[model samples]
Target: MIKVGIVGGTGYTGVELLRLLARHSGVKLQAVTSRKEAGMKVAEMYPSLRGWVDLAFSTPEDARLTECDVVFFATPNGIAMQQTGELLDAGVKVIDLAADYRIKDLSEWSKWYGMQHASPDLVEEAVYGLPEINRAAIRDARLIANPGCYPTAVQLGFLPLIEAGVIDAGSLIADCKSGVSGAGRKAEVGALFAEAGDNFKAYGVAGHRHLPEIRQGLTRIAGVDVGLTFVPHLTPLIRGIHATLYAKITQDVDLQALFEQRYLGEQFVDVLPAGSHPETRSVRGANVCRIAVHRPQGGDTVVILSVIDNLVKGAAGQAVQNMNILFDLPEGTGLDIVPLLP
Candidate 1:
């Protein structure tokens, strides 16, 4: 079995990884690290894994992780930068669910993340872990920078249009809403039940950190510079991301024809059947990303609606998908579980 270690295992994304990896037939979860929860049983914190993962949370200094074949960094951004190089140098594969190695430009990463990158040189070598976009490179990579929740959904939704040059890159806008869990499992004033429950509001306006990451992805498809007005909203729900992307069409186009032709035969990314709308409830706990397209008359813009569970496809689930590719395993192995619909 492939031995796996997860750092920062006490967070929402780390626990989500444990939940999914517990059922993977070919994996042995060797270690999970959490400084605050060190010496505590993981199952105690999350009863959902009572009988599955019996390991205790340890500190990052634990020797058990160095022995594993692969390590997942589910820690905060700065935390992973300090340890990823050591793990990779030890011949262990690394996957970071943070912002440490996602952006190619170190200065840009530093500006948004509010700290100088500790391992700026390694940034170029870390593969972007969006399987649909960079699967080939991921297979040979020792470190994978798992795409962020918002970027994953937005990039996937708009990639087709950018590729086809059907929309003006300067006129792009992504209005995304994510569940509270996307902010992490911390006791911040903004994440309190009182602050989030029964309320919906936009927080990050023009300069959200995710803007650069999204632009980086669009640049790849457009083969040139791209810009976007990215606004994010915090929903009272616990786990999902809905991204509504709008862009001015450069020419008259058929929405159905564009989406259908672009996503044909693409696994895990589905373009809904004609005239159908997708919901976050339909994709919760699953790796699927459902998208629908529309081009209403009297408007020169086209709208692309996309939805995904922020924790699943947006985080842990996509990390597992990257792991599958790194090992030459079938793209969907151990991840074929369907979405748990309401």
Candidate 2:
């Protein structure tokens, strides 16, 4: 069995990791760290795991992370970089569910995240953990930099077009909306029910942190620097990400066929039949990205709708998927969870 440890087990992504790992047949939960919640039973803090997780949260200092086969950092950005080197040296594979090592350019990452990268040397070494794009690299990587929530949705929507050279990569727009839970389990005025609920508004138009990460991934796929205007909105719901992507068509091809063929063998990416609009709820609670392609009135602009559960495909679930790849397990092992629908 693969021994696993999770750092930062108090946030939404952290608990989501626990929920998924608890039932993984091939995994043995070794340790979960939470400085503040140390000594608290995992089930006591999150009743959802009452019967599955009997381990108590331990402080990072007390956790036996080096002994685990793989350690997932579900903590904030800086935390992982601070300790990843030691973990990797100890033969422990590390997967960071944060932006600590996603962007290859350390200066650019610093500019956007507003913090000096603690381990800039590891930036180039950490493979970006998007299985659809970097599956081969992830298999041999000891350090993984998981893609951000918005980037995951937006990139999956635009990848096929970019790869086929059918869309103008110079001017791409990602108008994405995410649920309140994407903000993490925090006590912030902006994330409070009274402020986020019954409201729909876009923030970070000036430039969200995910913008660079998206551009970086798209640029790699397009083989050129891609221009992207990414705007993120906060919806009142608790889970899901809806990304409406727009790109100018440079060629005329059957978009439905293109998407279908592009993701023909991808287990997590679902390409809907033509004229279908994917809903975020359809992918809720599951590690899946449901997409639909359209060219309204046969215009030059092509629109793609992509949806996924932010905490699942966008975070913890994707982390687990990467773990499966790293361990040479079935790609869908422990991730065959059906989407939770209303």
Candidate 3:
């Protein structure tokens, strides 16, 4: 069995990882670290895992965390970079759910995250863990950097067009809306229900951190530097992301044929019928990305709509999928399940 350890085990992503990994056939829960919740029963903190995970939150230390074969860092940015090398040195593979290793350039990483990257040398070896695009790289990588929720939905929505050279990369604009949980489980006044509910307004329009990461992903697939105007907002609900992307098609492009042909054999990505719109609830709790295409009259712009559960496809579930690839296991071994809807 694959013994697994999780750092920063008290957050939303951390608990979601425990929820999936607890029932995972090939994994064994070994250690979970939390600085403040040390010596506390993990199940007590999140009663949802009372019977499944039988462990306590421990302090973050090299010796305690290095025991597992694979470790997941669900902490904030900069925390993973500090100990990634040490864990890798001790023969433990790592997958960071934070933004630590997402951006390639160290200067850019510093500029956006507002901290110096602790391990720039290992940046070359760290693979960006989006299973659909970088599966092979993730298989051989000892350290994987998972993408942000907004970036995941946005990138997957535009990848095919960009890859086929049908759209002009400079004119891409992403307008995304995410559920409240995407903000994490921190105690902040702005994230409270009163502030977020019955409210739909944009934040981080001036400059969001995910902007560079989105550009980096597009640049890799398009083989050119792509420009983006990304604006994200908070929805009242608790768990999903809906991304609407608009781009100018430079060439003669058959929208339906392009999407259908591109995702022919893709298991998790569902390209809906010609005019069908997919709702966020349709893909909740599933590792699925539902996409639709539209072309309005009198314009060369092609609009793409993509939806995914922010916590599942966007975070924990995708992390587990990356682990499956890194261990040479079936990509859908532990994630081939249906979405949970009300």
Best by TM-score: 2
Q: Residue by residue across 226-276, what tens digits does model 2's lDDT show?
A: 989888999999999999999999999999999999999999999999999
Q: Quote model 1's TM-score.
A: 0.97
Q: How does each model score on lDDT?
A: 0.90, 0.94, 0.91
Taking the tens digit of each residue's C-alpha lDDT, what string does model 3 give over 106-172?
8998999998888999988899998879988898999999889999999999999999999999889
Task: Name the 10 consecutive residues with the lowest summed lDDT in model 3.
Answer: 59-68
Q: Candidate 3 regions off by >4 Å?
A: none
Highest lDDT model number:
2
1 or 2, greater by TM-score: 2
Provide the lowest-lDDT 10-residue window in model 1.
294-303
Residue-by-residue lDDT tens digits, candidate 1, 1-342: 889999999899999999999999879999999888899999999999999999999887874777999999999889889988888888999999999999998889888999999988789999999988898899999999999999999999999888888889987999999999999998998889999999999987958999999999999889989878999999999999999999998977777788888778777898997667789999999888999988767488888899999998999999999998898777777788888867
- Which of 2 and 3 is the better model by lDDT? 2
Clash pairs (backbone) in predicted model 2: none
Evaluate model 2: give its lDDT.
0.94
Error of 3 at 268 (Å): 1.7
Give me candidate 3's TM-score against the actual structure.
0.97
